[model samples]
Target chain A: MIASLRLRAAVVSIVLLAVFLGAWHLATRSTGTAANMSPEYAKLMGMTATQGKSAMPGPLDVGAKLWEHLRRPFYDNGPNDKGLGIQLAFSLGRVMLGYLIAVAIAIPLGFLIGMSPLMSKALDPFIQILKPISPLAWMPLALYTIKDSSLSAIFVIFICSVWPMLINTAFGVASVRKEWINVARTLEVGNFRRAFTVILPAAAPTILTGMRISIGIAWLVIVAAEMLVGGTGIGYFVWNEWNNLSITNVIIAILLIGLVGMVLDQILARVSRLVTFPE
Target chain B: MSIFDDPFDADSRVNAGCICGQHRSPAEHEHAMSALRCEPVVESQEKRYENVVASAVLRAVFPEATTRRAFLKTVGAATALAAVSQFFPLKTATEAFAEAGTPEKKDLKVGFIPITCATPIIMAAPLGFYAKAGLNVEVVKTAGWAVIRDKTINKEYDAAHMLAPMPIAISLGLGAQPIPFTVPAIENINGQGIVLSMKHKDKRDPKDWKGLKFAIPFDYSMHNYLLRYYLAEHGIDPDTDVQLRSVPPPEMVANLRADNIDGFLAPDNICQRAIYDGVGFLHILSKEIWDGHPCCSFAASREFITSAPNSFAALTRAIVDATAYASKAENRKQIAEAIAPANYINAPVTVLEQVLTGTYADGLGGVKTDPKRVDFDPFPWQSFAVWMLTQMKRWGQIKGDVDYKAVAEQIYLATDTRKVMIEMGLTPPKDSYKSFSVMGKSFDPTKPDDYVASFKIKKAS
Candidate 1:
């Protein structure tokens, strides 16, 4: 019965996609041609004036462009024009470097805050204030202070991802069961060993959950950060296409961005699942 | 290393002693010699041209090579130059032949907002003008005017394509910190237009545009001042009569299509793009208000000019060369194809062709041809700065006492540009200041205060 339900759901998803594409194709079909235009003038008018094509690209146009991009995804023409693969690699590289740095700093600091109530209260106010400020808002300040556009983009990712991991790790570590700690203490395991052997195991699932949240936020913010500080990234690609007013390329970029974001989330979700323990 | 050292004799060590006995060993002397050789060996452009001209004159004077060599050996090279100068105007010919010097720093990054006003600067990168001037320049497409200013001020860019009034505003510390900026060359003139949304096709008059929303590229731009002047001349105050927003040129067409703005006064390429996309129509080219008005410029900080004078001169020569090339009507189509790629302006080739070639569809079922819709001229007139300053004062952007001429001369660099233009074989205007009329009102650079007072619908400061 469950297998049949899964099959039915997949069929419905495919049908929905097909319907959407059909509507898009019909909506953008050519309407009426202007026949009286001179050949010289008609050539300059583009397809919109001569053949009566819509300004918006049809689904087939977008699909063809997407296929063209996929065939050779790493061709770099210049500083402003690079293939999709190269742009995605640049954005992923920035996100990974920033996410790793955030993990290194936040996990350790969060452990300290979780173990001591006083320390948690002291750092709480600072984190609370920083957490609500939009990541893009920090761009100008980062660019001014960092003096490098690429590094500033990485810094924005780090600042944005750090807050989620910090908060979740602290909450998980602070809420560890009292009975497990007491048993470890009675066995004379010492503060260091007991915390590592017992407390770490109990909080592993929560820390992984925090990491999943942080990675998702980082992926979301990288696009916006890269758009603001344009050089070579998927965000820059979108901006470049937008400047050209190529809506088809922009739609393709949107689709690719969504696919990449989902893949990142799925990987983190899988890792979090592995760390979860059954009582 | 000594010339007197005998290598054949076992007792005499040739490689052991310095030539002048100034160093410990021959190796050290050789190292010192190489270091000296590395020091600026590339001659100045003028010097190189002079040598070539002097040699040609000597060859003409003596058809036989033996006789020319004998003459040079007897009189020496300096005496030959002195003799040649007596008969021929060698100095004047050399000045004419001198194109550009070897750049002190060849690899440069120039920031630009994607627009037709940056034609010379953008086209130079692809057409090899920078390479011809011994420069390896990368023209970067920036996001907006503010980013261009910041990147240039931060030294992230070696120079930038800026609005004609930006250098003046930057030097005066209007929007940003006071940085001594100079406009060595105006990039293009008469390249902007007022593009209105398609819904406003019937509403052609400025009187009908009172309650409509409009966008300008920047607050301290020629677009803002021109739009304001045009509106006020039509008996409508820009500040109170309509809503004005500062939108980047790239986003202007999108905004117009979405009904976020009713119109915009922007670069010609942007105006053309809106028409091409079937969203907007050209209301009036900027030249209709003031023919041959300055729009955008090639700007650099004073620090850059002082520190790297040769590179700056080479850059200026490249821009002037490109401007001269673009001014011709025949080269417009080729330039449009070159800059339409994703790396530069990132617009459709047809849109760029319409802008550069000045034969375009006006989105009202009519094809119009006005070759001077956009034109390139590298001369930075100080009078343009004076006119902009008067508008700034009239709009209350500047307050109290002002020295218009001093500021204009300080930022415009008209005299320096004149020298460069003469070197490039392009004839610049004889005088740096010229009085012109805007909307039937004459503006004399000598009397800026009177021009400001003449404005009836001013900011009332």
Candidate 2:
């Protein structure tokens, strides 16, 4: 029965996508073939102007461009132009580097804040003020202070990713059950050992949840950061195509961004599942 | 055949001379001559360098080609060089020029918005102008004029392709902290146009533009000033009668198609792209408002110039060299191809060709040709700067008392450009100030206050 339900759900998803695509295709179909235009004049006109095609590209146009990109996805022509695979790799690389750095700094600081009441209160005001600010807002400041664009982009990602993990880790560590700590203390476990063997294990699920949230946020911010400081990345690709007003390439970039974001989320979700323990 | 070839020698043909003197045009002669006299400069590299320097100094002292040639013929090249070296440190200057050829920093980054206004800066990279000058320069395609300004100011970029007024604005502390910036060279002139959406094709006259929204690339851009001037001349107050938004050049076409803007005064390529997209048609070229008006510039900070003078000079030489090549009509098609790659301007070849070649469809089912639609000239005239300042003050961007001439001379590096032009064997303009008219009203660079006061429709001070 469960398998049949899954099959029915998949069928519905496919049906919805098909209907959407069909409507888009019909809406964008060529309506008038430009008649009586000289060959020389037609050569200078865009596809829409000459063939009476809609300005908005249909799914087929996007699909064809996507297929061309997929066939050779690692071509690096120069700094401004790179293949989709290379662009994606550059973006993922930045996100991973930034996310890992955030994990390193946030986890330890979070532990200190979580374990001590005084530290938590002292740091709370600063965190509260900073947590709500958009990552892109720091672009100009980061660029000015750091004096490097790529490093600034990575720094932006780190700042955005830290707040979520820091807050969640502190919350999880602070809320450990009193009974578990009492049992560990009574057994003569040293403070260090207790942290590693008991507190860490007890808060593993929550900490992993925090990491998962951070990875998602980091992925989201990388696109915007790379877009702002363009050199070589998926965000740069979107911007380059947008400069030419190539909607088809932009659609492909959007689709790729969504897919990459999903993959990053799934990886963290699986890690979160690994740390979750049944009572 | 070459500028360096001796015009005094009866055996040599110096000024676009055909092998048989039967070619229909200079371009045809060049095509037919091919590689015959291209090896005219057979001197050693060092000798050629000294010769160029000597000739420039002689030309400067004489100010007349005939007298210089007569002097050279009388005393011979070696004696003439020795005589000049006595008055001027010829040997020391030659060594310095040679040393400056090896740039202090080899790797550099230049920021540019992907537009035809940046043709020389962009083409310099792909066509080996930078490499030839012993620098590996990466022309990073920037997102917008604001980002370009920020990145350059942060020292992330070595230099940048900027709107002509940007360096002035930066130097004067408008919209950004006052950082001493300099315009080493003007990139292109007369390369902008006012494009109206196809729906408003009949509304060509500026008087009919009231209640319509328009987009300019930036608040301090030539596009904004020209658009405002055009409107004010037509009795339409830009501030009260119509709305103007600061839209980046790249997004103008999409915005026009989306019906977000009725028109835009932007770079010629953006104007061409709008017509290519069938969303807009050319209302009037900016050249119609003011021909030979400065649009974009090759700018660097004063800090960069002080820290790395040699590299800055090399970069400027590459730009000036590329500008000279792009000035000729025959080279336009080749340049269009070189800058059309995905890594550069990233536009269709035909769109670029139409913009560069100055022959394009007007989106009204008509083909119009105007070769001077976009031309490259690298002189950074201080008079242009004075004109811009007057407009800035008139538009209320600058308030209180102003020293227009001092500011213009400081921001526009006319002296530096003159030196570079002489070094390259090109004639530098005698004076940095010249009067030019905008919309039938002449501007006297010597009297900027008068010009500012004369604007009838301006932001009331």
Per-residue lDDT of A1-279 in model 1, one digit per residue for the tens? 999999999999999999999999999998876647666666666676567788799999999999999999999888888999999999999999999999999998998899998999999999999997888899888877777777888999999999989998888889999998888878888889977888778888889888888998898888888777777899988888888889999999999999999999899899888888899
The residue-by-residue lDDT of candidate 2 on B1-461, one tens digit each, is: 34353423333322334544434357765653432211112443356567676665776777765666677778876777678878997777776775465678889999999999999999999888888677999999998888899899989899999999999999999999899999999999898998999899778778888899999999999999999999999999999999999998888888898899999999977899999988999988899999889999999999999999989999998898788778878889999999998999999999999999999998888888999899888888899999999889989999998899899889899899888766665545547887778988988999888888887899987
**Residue-pair clashes per candidate, as listed?**
0, 0
Task: Name model 2 segments beyond 4 Å from true.
Answer: A117-125, B1-100
* A75-186: candidate 2 lDDT, tens digit per residue: 9898889899999999999999999999999998888799998999999999999988898899889977887889999999999999989998898889999999999999
* Residue A272 lDDT, candidate 2, scale 0-100: 84
lDDT of 1 at B139: 88
Residue B210, candidate 2: how far off, in angstroms?
A: 2.2
- What TM-scores do the predictions have? 0.86, 0.89
Residues B334-437, candidate 1, lDDT per residue (tens digit)?
Answer: 99999988888898888899988899887776789999899887878899999999999999999887899999999999999888765543335557887878
Query: In candidate 1, residue B31 scores what lDDT?
Result: 67
Kindly report the docking quality category of candidate 2.
medium
Model 1, residue B91: distance off in Å is: 13
lDDT of 2: 0.86
